[model samples]
Target: MSEKLKVGITIGDVNGIGLEVIIKTLANNRILDFFTPIVYGNTKVASFHRKAIGITDFSFNVINSADQASEKRPNMINCWHEDVKIMLGESNSIGGKYAFLSLEKATDDLIQGKIDVLITAPINKHNIQQDEFNFPGHTEYIQSKTGSKDALMFMISEELKIGVVTGHIPVKEIAENITKETILAKLRLMHNSLKNDFWVQKPKIAVLGLNPHAGDNGLIGSEDQDIVIPAIEEANEMDVFAFGPYPADGFFASDNYKNFDGVLAMYHDQGLIPFKQLAFHNGVNFTAGLPVIRTSPDHGTGYDIAGKNIASEQSFKEAIFAAVHIAKRRKEQDDLLANPLKIRKLTKDRD
Candidate 1:
C-alpha cells in the first residue's frame, strides 16, 4: 500500500548473539520486501559479526542520525558510541552502557516517529544496569520511558500466545502482585492489543491459576480463589471473553489451551516453560499495550553460544515478520475505518 514501514532494531548485549541473529535474519532477501529494517547499534560490531559468520553480501550504510536513514533501502543506521571494541561473550560496564544507550536511541527515534515499529534483541539484565539506568528489562524500561502503566510482555507463536500478569519479579512477590485491578488492567491491554495491534477481532483469552490445580479449591492456596477468580469475574462482567483459573501443571498438557487466542499466566515461568518447549526456535516475545510495536526473540542472550555463528535466527526472523504483518494489518484497518462503506461491504460479504 505504502512504502515498507521502517523498523528500528536495537542490538541487545553486543557480547551475545544479538548481532549474529540480525546478520542472519537480514541476509534473507524476502525481509527487505516486507519492511525497511534499520539497526541502531555499533556498525563496527555488526561488521565484525558479519565477517565472523562468513556473510559477505550484506552491508550497513552508517548514518549520523535517524533522519539520515534511507527509507528506500535496508540500512544498519549506526547509533554507535564507544564500546565497539568490546569482546564477544564477555560482559563489561562499557558494553552494558552502550546496550542501554542503544535502547535509549531507539526510543527517541520511536517517539519521533522516524521508525514505525521497534524490535529489540536480547540484552543481559545484570549487565544493563548503569549509574543512571535502573530498569530491569526492556518491558519495564519501555513502560517507564513511555509512562504506560498497562504494558505487558507476551510470548507468541502460531499455536500459542502467552502473557504474564507479573514479570521480572521474584516468585515470593507474585501472589501479593495478583489483584483485581492489576488483572483487569492486563486483560484490557491484552484485549486491545489483540484487536488493534494483532488484528484479531473478538479474541478469546484464557487465564491461568497461580497455584496448582487452581489452589485446589483454596486448599492449596487462597490467591487463586480470592484474587484470580474475582478478577476474572469482573472482567467477564465487563463482556470480556476470559475463562480460566487453570492449573499451570496440566494446562499445556491438555487440548484445553487450543480453544483460546491467548493465555494469561500468573507470572513468567508459569507461561514461558511451555512456550519455550513448544516454539523456542520460532517464538516471538512481544510487548503489548505500547504506543509503538515491539518484539524480540523468546530466547535470551545465550552467552555460552555467543560468537559461535551457530545460533539459530529462526525466532528473530519470526519476530521481524510478525512485526511487519501486524504493522500492515493495523494500517489496513485504519484505512478501512476511514472508509466505512468498504468495511460494511466486507462484513456483509463475510456474513
Candidate 2:
C-alpha cells in the first residue's frame, strides 16, 4: 500500500490563536488517518499554548524531519529553541518573528518535496514584515518562492468558491489595477484549479462587476462593460465557460452564487466580505494556480480572543481537509497524465 501523504503545517503568530486552533484540531487524533501532519514550530511554544488553553491531555511528538514524522502520532519539528515570552491576545513583533520562522521552515520542506501539502495558520501581516518576508501576504510570498507568474487567492467552502482579481491592495487602487488582461488571467487560473485541484470538469465561473448593480448597464462605471465583459468573452473563446459581470451586492443576497462552480469578484472585499459572512468559521483560503498546493483558514490572527481558548478551530480543521483532498486530487491527476500517449495508443489498438 502507498504511504500516507505528509502534510506540512506552520504555526502562525504564537501570541495569537494559531496554536490554539491547531492544538484543538489535532487533539482529536482522528485526523491522522488521512495525512501525517508535520508542524513547523517549537515544542515548548506549543506546550505554552496548550497549557494556556487548559488542554493537558494533548501533546505533539517532536521530530527533526518529515521522514522522521510518526504515522500514528501528531508530529512537530522544533524550528527554534530560543526562549520567548507568550503574551496571548497581543499583536507584537515577537509574534511575527516566530511566525515567519515556522513558515520559512515549512516552506523549505514543501519546496524540497519532503512534504506533500502545506497548511499555514493565521499570521500578523504587519509585524511579519522583514527583509526576508516583505510581501503583502503568504500567497504572494509563496508565488515568488515557487517562481510562479501568478497565484489566485481562492476562497473555498462546501457550497461556494470565490476568487478576487486584486488582493491586498488599497480600495482606491482596485479599479485601476483591474483590467481585461488581469481578469482573463484570474479566470483561466480559477478554471484550471477547479478541474485540477477540486476535480470539477467543465467548470462554469461567475464574474462580478466593479461597480454597483453591474455599473447599472454603464450608468455607474464603464469598467464592467469595457474591462470585465470583454475579459469574460475572451475567456469563453479560450474554451473556458466564463459568465457574467453580476452585481456583487445582489449576487449573494439572492442566492445566485449557488448555481455556479466558482465566482470571480473584481476586488478583495467584494469577494471576501460576502464569503466570510457566510463561511467564516469553516472557509479555507486556497492559493491556486501554483506548482504546489497551499491552504489556510479563512480567518486571521484572533488577537482579541487569543489565549482564552474561545477561538474556534473549525476553519483550521477545514483547511486541513481541503489541503489533503487537493493534494490527493493533484497527485491522481499527475499520475493519469504522466504518459498520455501510451494510453492513447492502447485505446487505438483496442479499436
Candidate 3:
C-alpha cells in the first residue's frame, strides 16, 4: 500500500476561528483515511480551542517536525513554545504575530518539499502585516515566496471557477489597471492554469468587462471595447479559446457563466462577490500559477463567532479535500508524462 499524502495546514489568526474550524474538520476520524494531517500550530493553542468548542475527545499527535507526523492520527507542530494569550473574537497583535509564524513555518516546509500540499485557514490581513510578511494577501505572499512570475487568485467550486485580473487592489484603481497587456497576461495565466492544474483540455474562458453593461459599447466606459476586447482577440490569436468582455451583471444573473469552463473578471470584487454568494460554504480559494499547491477556505476569519462553536467547517474540509484531489491528479499526470504509453498499430502482416 502507498503512504498517505502529508497535508500541511497553517492555523490562521489564532484569535479568530482558525483552530476551531480545523478541530471540527479533523474531529471526524474518517478524514484521516484520505491524508496525513500535519498542523503547524502549538499544542496548547489546539487544546485551548478544542476545550472552548466543547470537543474533549479530540487530541493531536504533537510532533516537532513533519517527518514525525503520524498517518493514523492528526499531528501538530509547535511553531512557538512560549505561552501566548488567547483572545478569541478579537484581532490583536499577538494573533497576527503567531499567524505569521505558523504560516512562515508551513511555507518553508512546503518549499522544501516536506509536505505534498498546504491548506491555510483564515487570516486577519491587516493585523498580520509585518516586515517579512508585507503583502496584500496569501496569494501574493506565496507567489513571492515561491518566486512564481505570476499568481492567479482562482476561486473554485463545483458550480463555477473564477479568476481575477487585478487582485487585492482598490476599486478606484481598477480602471487604470485594466490595460490590454494586463488583461492578456491574466488571461494567459488563467488559460494555462485551467489546462495544466485543473486538467481541463482546451478550456473556454469568458472575460468580464471592467464597467457596467460591458461599457455599453462606450456608453458607460470604453475599457471593455478599448482594452478587454482587443486582449480577448489577441488571446484567440494565441489559440487560447478566449471569449467575451461580457457584461458582469447579466452574465452571472442570467446564468450565462455556465457556458464557459472559466470566467476572468476585471478585479477582485467583480469576481469574488458573485462567487461567494453562489458557493460560500463549499468554495475553495486555489492559488494558481504557484510552484506548490495551496488552497484556503472561501470565507474569512469568523470574528463574530470565533469561539462560539458556530463556525462551519465544511469549506475548510472541502479545501483540504480539494488540495488532496489536485495533488493526486497532478502526480498522476506527472507519472504519465514520465512513462508515456506508446501506441502500436496492427497491420495485416502482423495479425
Candidate 4:
C-alpha cells in the first residue's frame, strides 16, 4: 500500500512513434500519482524522440534497474547503450533489433517480479522476428515467456470487450483453426477475466458466428453450426453465460455488442475491426489468461506519422491505466481467495 504499482514499459520500434507517445504520456506528472513507470529503453533514444517531437522540458530518471524506479518521476533503463541511428518513419532491421532488446528486458523484469505490470509500445510485426523472438505478436510472445497455457487477445474499452479464438493468423488458416475446443478455451478465459480483472460478477458473453448468417443455418458453411454452437452449449455448463453464433455483420451494425458483458469473435479482424472502428484512439489491447498483467495500445507502429508529433498518446495512456487497474483487481481477488471464510462471513452479515 505504501508504493504505487510499478509499470514496466517497452519502447517498441525506435523508427516508429513508440517513444513519442511514451514520452507524451509520461510527461503528464498527474499519472505518476497512480503508478510508477519504468521504461526499458535507451536514454539516448528517448532523447532523440523527445527532440523530434519538440518536447523540451520532460526528462526520464535514469535508473539501473526497475527496482530503483522513482515513484515521483518517470524512469528509464538503457536496454542498449550504443548510439543507434534515428531514422524516424522508416522500417529497417535496426528498429527491430533494438525493439526486441527493450521488450526482452522489460519482459524479464516482469516475469521476475520486479515490476507489477507491463505496458508495451507498438512493434513492427514483420521486422521484429528472429531466433529469439519469432512469434506472431506480443500476445503469443508473452504467453510463451510467462509459460501460460492460453492467451486471449482481448481488446478492451469503456463499453466494448472482445476476444478472439484465433489471432495473428492468415485468413486461410482461420477456418481450420476454429474448433470447438479453441472456442471453449477462449470462452473460459474471457469469463474468468471479466469476473476477476474487470470485476464482473456474472459475465454474459456473446459468441460470433464464423460463417455468414451463422452459416445461414447450415447453408453457407457448417463450421458455425457444427463447431461454434457446440462450444456455446458446453460453455453454459461451465458457468459461462455464452450465447449466439450471431451474424457478425448485423451484430456490430445493430450495436448489439452493447447488450452483452463481453464478445468472443471467431478470429482477429472479425472482433478487432469493429472494436477499432469504435474506440481506435483509446482501446487497450489486453493479453488475457496470463499469470502476469500486460496491455498495449490498440494501434501499431506508426511509421506513417513517426516523429511528426501528430500521433495521439490516448491509447498508450489508456493501456497503462488499464494494466494498473487490473493489477489492483487481481490483488484484491487474491486477498479474498486467501480468506474465503472471512469474505463469506462479511457477506452474510451484510445480507
The C-alpha TM-scores of every prediction are 0.95, 0.96, 0.96, 0.98
The predictions' CA RMSDs to the true structure, in order, are: 1.7, 2.5, 3.1, 1.2
- Alpha-carbon lDDT, every model: 0.84, 0.92, 0.91, 0.94
lDDT score for residue 197 of model 4: 96
**lDDT of model 2 at residue 309?**
82
Locate the minimum summed-lDDT window of 10 residues in model 3. Answer: 340-349
List, residue by residue over 1-351, the lDDT tens digit for candidate 4.
334899999999999999999999999999998999999999989999999989999999999998798999999999888899989999999999999999999999999999999999999999999999999989999999998899899999997999999999999999999999999999999999999999998999999999989899899999988999999999999889999999999999999999999999999999999999999898999999999999999998999999999999999999999999999989888888899997898679879
Misplaced by over 4 Å in model 2 are 339-351
Return the TM-score for candidate 4, rounded to 2 decimals.
Answer: 0.98
Candidate 3 Cα outliers beyond 4 Å, as residue runs: 1-3, 342-351
> Candidate 1, residues 1-351: lDDT per residue as tens digits?
356788889988888889899888888777677778888888778888888778889887777776666655557766655546768778776668777878899988887788888889999889899765787789888877787867979998998889999998999898889888998888988888888877778989899998889999989999888889999999988877799888877888886888898899999899999999988898999988887778889888877888888999999989988887778877888889999998999999989
Worst ten-residue run, lDDT, model 4?
Answer: 1-10
Q: Rank the candidates by lDDT, best first.
A: 4, 2, 3, 1
Q: What is the lDDT of residue 189 in candidate 3?
A: 83
Candidate 2: C-alpha lDDT: 0.92
Q: Between which residue pairs do clashes occur in model 4? A: none
